[model samples]
Target chain A: MSPFLLLLRLRLMEVFRVRFTGFFFLGLPLLFFALVGVIFSSGHPFAHRRVVMVATAADENRSSEMLVAMARFTEIRVERAATHEAAMGKLRAQIVNAVVEPLSDGSGYRLIVGGFDELFGRGLVTALPGHVELAVAPLERWGFVHYAFAGMLVFCVAISGLFGMGYNMVRYRQNLFLRKLSTTRLSKSTFVAAQIAGRGIWSLVQVLLLLALAHLLFSLPLSLVAALWTLGLTVLGLCAFLGIGFLLACFIRTEGLIYDAISSIAWPIVLLSEFFFPADELPSPLRFAAAALPSTQLVRLLRAVLLYGETDVASLLPGIAIILVWIVMTFTMGRFFFRWND
Target chain B: MGFGDQDALLLKVVIAAARLTKRFGSVVALENVSFQIEGPQLICILGPNGAGKTTLLDLLEGLSQPDAGEIRLFGTPLSARRYPRERVGVVLQKEFILDGITVGEYAELFATIQGVKGAQQILSQARLQDRAKTPLSKISNGESQRLFIAAAAVHHPELLFLDEPTAHLDPGAKLEVGRLLTEMSSEHTVVMTTHDLREADTLSDHVLFLVDGKLKAEGAPATLIDSIPPAARGHGTLEEAFFHFCAARLTARGDIEPVRP
Candidate 1:
């Protein structure tokens, strides 16, 4: 075999052999998606209300069915408030979590959660006026798990490139495998290219497997266009993350230090980027910083394409440009500071 | 000497360096060091710890560059793009393993890298074919050392650089590797570093003695012995001669006063 091809094959084989690579880079993403998917898809009808005030009518028998239905929620504490102003006073005093006003037309109770800030307030408002007959939507068209799944895919891409390609470089350097290779006729560029190619192929496989499983299990709206978009974004994400990994590996001297350093950088960016929840509620500067992270852009592009079926290539230019800028910057730094011995 | 003899000498000189100097921050690793090696000889570089022995090998093997010097391998300048890499091999002091790879797989990887087809033969010569299928983690330190030799020699490099290759091995393993290296020295020029004076006496045809990043002496073992004073010889054999050189440098620098009779 050609030397580059041999190197690529050996690299991929080594990645497959190491249990850590298999577990974290490839398997963990699918596992997280499944767990998060089930949890998010299992929505409850009365989950939106935790505490509510009932404005009982003069007869008190008009809304007996509604009161009984509200009473069914074990987590919610429902009490009788005489008037809307009294309910507002209770909410301001932090006494009652929300107020449920009786509708004049007897359609259903109107939920009035004051100072709509907390999730409880939002939930109450979302399920108001139809509390007796309302059922929680089975799954959101672009629900919590859908957002989480996008982030997970991008995170998998980053981890695979960082650990699979970057960590391997550090290991090879530490063990003097790189020095040994240096003495051979194999050019360093060829060796590095082989590394990138092996990781790229593995990431492609991961994308295929993740999309196929998601389509089969959760009925994710996976189309040929979505697959293509995901594949493209994954490739770009791998390049950016692999560059970051190389940048870290170029300076970090030990296996332990590399893990800590990668986690410190990756976790913060992932968390602050509104990966698990919405970042729009975050402070302005923090939200701006999160948007600047390449990973954040990757997740956004992926979510846009997958959930919303956004096909406009022009709309994605800014994200692509951000990711590309990161790729160039990190790749340059990694190469500039790289030392075979260290 | 005749012109033909001069031609033979020119052809025999496989490695030559002139005024090589290397520094690591404030510390000088090698200073104005120069040497030449002709083919088919085992040269042992003897030095104290931190004596720039490994640094010299690293520069010679093209693993590093000198601060201000030039090296020629096979009569080509080291800076040349076509410097002969396939004709050289190196075994570092530390035992580096590919972790999950088997001995055979490791050998094959290097063989392929160097464009050689002698993985089996190299493993057999190192007497490691029996353990070829075993993972590197499962192999003994001695077996791993032998594998290093086999991998380094798989392409039959004309010049081999070994940095303290047997310093950590058991006595038996050392002897075994010594025998293998001795056999290899019949065709390939081997350069190695060792703290063991006896191992050097046994394996080397020439000795390059170093002390504190400086080449204190270079020649056959007998030549270095001859340089020792008659009185110093009475203190011991080769060990006394080595000390004589180190003390000579110290005394010359006025670090220690000479003893009076």
Candidate 2:
């Protein structure tokens, strides 16, 4: 057998030797995709709003009609009150989005919105007559499944890449397995290539499990070309991240330092990568930082292929370029910094 | 296929170091060190902790590169580009954790790396045949060390470098390992490093004493021991002679700075 294949087999065997790691590699992504499919297939769960209608004595008829119209556009349950005081009490209890008060002149109506009901108030005002007034509570948008999937994917990649490469390389070094290999006639390039190939193969298994789960439970559509691209990109991304992890192992002496640095690098990458939201939606500097991250490129690429069925290499060229640059840079850095006999 | 006698010698000089020097950020680990050995010679490099013994072995084994020197094996320069991996075997100090892999699996993997046949024969030779199916984690420390030796030698390397191979072993295991090394020297050039003077005296056909990053003395163990000053010789032990040599060097150096006093 080729030296590369021999080393690759050893690495794969090592990865599977860790019991929970095997479960994590197979189980976690499946659970994530299943949860995403379930949640998104339904709607956003934490975004409910209530709209309230209040009628003044003079314009009671007009206010009632406006309330009914607003009800058609939302899940609003109307509560009628004889006085404005009673309407205010309902608003305070957080049971309403807006209280509509009819105008004394009988020409228009006024809608008083609760402090916590912005979406419903906005919907009511925008969907109602020109003379209608609205007081809207501030809106807090809850993330949906698309957002959740993006976040989970970033997390999965970071956890898998960091611990997988860091712990494995350190173990190899501490055990002198790498030192023994260094004594061989095998080139450093071949050794590194075997490592990347090993990680790529393992990540492919993970992606397959994730995709299978996505298909069965989430009804995730699979375009042949898109699926292939997603798989390729995932492998590429794994190589890049694993390269960084190898570099971390090379530079850091202690396992504790390695764990700390890995987590420190990983958490920030997750928070600032814009995996769960558009970069434009984040703070300005954070958005700029996110745009430059490899994770961002990977997430964008995966989402495009998996969610939108865009498999054109031309469309994915930028993301692919970013990930490719990361891979080359990290691999080169690792090779440069690695000490064979420390 | 048949080979001439000259062709046989050509295969015997498994390792050849020419002016090997290594530096770690201004501290010289090895300096102008040159050595050559042929198969059937069990050579021991004797040095204290910082005497550049491990450095020399590492350079010979291709684990590290020299700052200014060359290493040649079988008349070809030793390098990742020139040498095939199966040609050299190395046993390190620390034992590797093969995780869930059984001792047999580890042996087989090493055999595969060595590109060899008869892995079972090698396991038996290493005296690990009975425990072949046992997990590596369950193996005794001495057995682990033997397993490493077996794995390294499975390919029947042209040259072998063992760095303190018996450091963690019991007395019985050490003797067993020493015997194995003696047998291996018949087919492979063996270069082993150790601080254990007894091990050096017992196993080495040629002793290389390194002091302060340079080769201080070299000869057969008896010859080197006999060369020591008469007053320092006691029980004619090689260990006594070694300490005598090292102590005399330090005392002579110490006297140079105290001339006025």
Candidate 3:
């Protein structure tokens, strides 16, 4: 066999034999995708419907008219509570979006809202009738998990390259396989190419597994072009992430240390990349920072393909350019810092 | 089966070093070290801990560079930038092969990397034929070392560098590997590092004793052993000779403490 084939075979064998790697790198991501899909796939049940508390005392006629109007609002669902205390308790529990009651001062009815800034609460107050003073609480963004499927796919690709290749490279270094190889006729370029090739092969397998699960579990939309673009983006994303992993491995000394390093790097990228929820609500500067991350661009690319069935390569030019730049920069940095011997 | 017409004298100098010096930060790892290995022989580098023994092997293997001086392999100057690494093999002190692969697979990988043949013969010579199917992680440490030797020898390198090859082996396994290495010496030059005086005395055709980053002595083990004073050679063993030599050097350098009582 050629050295490249031998190296790739050894890597695949190691990936399967090491129980932690096999399960965590390949199996866990599919499990996460399924679990998220099942939890959120039926669409947000209450995202469009607002739970409201109606508390009226001694003004039966006025309260009845107001309740009728509130019920007529398509986004509002009115729940009547017998006492003001009960209504406020439900508001504290977040069971109701806003609480409404007659004004104790008799000038007007005051709305007691929970969980939102007073500025936004004032808007709801003005939007209601003159006799109604409105308070409002924040609502979670609806239909987020629908897009979450796309986000998780990107997350899986990024972390599979980071954690998987990071550990492998660290093991090769700390265990002295790298040093031993250095003494052979094997060139450094061959060794590095072998590592990337091994990772590339495993990453393809992972993508296929995740896609299959997504189809079976969530009925994810998978048109032919969408699938092809997803595959292409996934490969590019893996290349960028593999380069990042290599750079991290060069800086770290031991396999054990890579866990902490990967977590610290992955969590921020995952959270900021809008993997689970949109980072749209974040401040513009912060969102801009998130946009600069490779994961963010990758998530955007995957979401376009899987959610919207976007398949045009020209529309994705900017994303592709960013990912390519990341690959080149990180790979160059990794080669600069790489050391074959300790 | 061998090409015998080539002049033996032309290939006599397998490795040469002159005034080699290496430093790490403020610590001098190797200082003004010079040595040579001629033809196929077992050369032992003996030293106490942190005495630059492994450093020397690393330098000669082209894994590291010296702050000063030069090294030549096969009569040509060796530098990491353009060293001809194909003619050499290395077995580290630790078990460094991939643990997930079978012994046979590991040997095959090394063979493939070196672009050589006969992994089966190398495994058999290392006495690992029966364990060919075993995972490296499942084997005992001694067995792992032997398997590493098999992998290192897969290329039939003209020069083999082993860093403390028998450091962790049991006595029986040590002797067995020693015998194997001695047998291999007739075909290729073997250079190894060890702290075991007995093993060094038993297996070495020539010994290089490094102390505190300096070459304290060099010669056949018997020559160094015979030079010890009769009173100092209480056991008539190399260990006693090594003790006397270190003590004598320390006394001359004013670092040895005077005996009391």
TM-score of chain A of each: 0.60, 0.58, 0.59
Number of the top lDDT candidate = 3
Interface RMSD of each: 1.5, 2.2, 1.4
Kindly list the per-residue Cα lDDT of model 2 for residues B89-197, writing each as its tens digit: 8887665675688989888877765666757966887789999889989988778877888788887777788899988789998998899889888887788998878
The residue ranges of model 1 lying beyond 4 angstroms of the native Cα positions read A1-142, A277-284, B1-12, B79-83, B225-261
Candidate order by decreasing TM-score: 3, 1, 2
List the candidate numbers ranked by lDDT, top first: 3, 1, 2
Candidate 3 lDDT for residue A314: 86
The DockQ of each candidate is 0.46, 0.34, 0.50
| Share of reference contacts kept by candidate 2 | 0.59
List runs of model 2 lying over 4 Å from the truth. Answer: A1-143, A211-229, B1-34, B67-72, B75-86, B225-237, B240-261
How many pairs of residues collide in model 1? Answer: 0
lDDT of 3 by residue, B1-261 (tens): 111343353256898788999999999999998877786899999877787998898889888999998887887778768777777878877657576788888878888888988678767877788988888788877777877887788777888889999987899889888988898899889999988888888899998888778887788888988998877677677666666665532345433221222
lDDT of each residue in A49-154, candidate 3, tens digit only: 3434445457676667667766767655566765665555445434445777777676666777765536535655776666767655453332244367667888
CA lDDT of A137 in candidate 2? 41
Against the true structure, what is each candidate's TM-score?
0.70, 0.68, 0.71
lDDT of 1 at A183: 71
- Top TM-score hit: 3
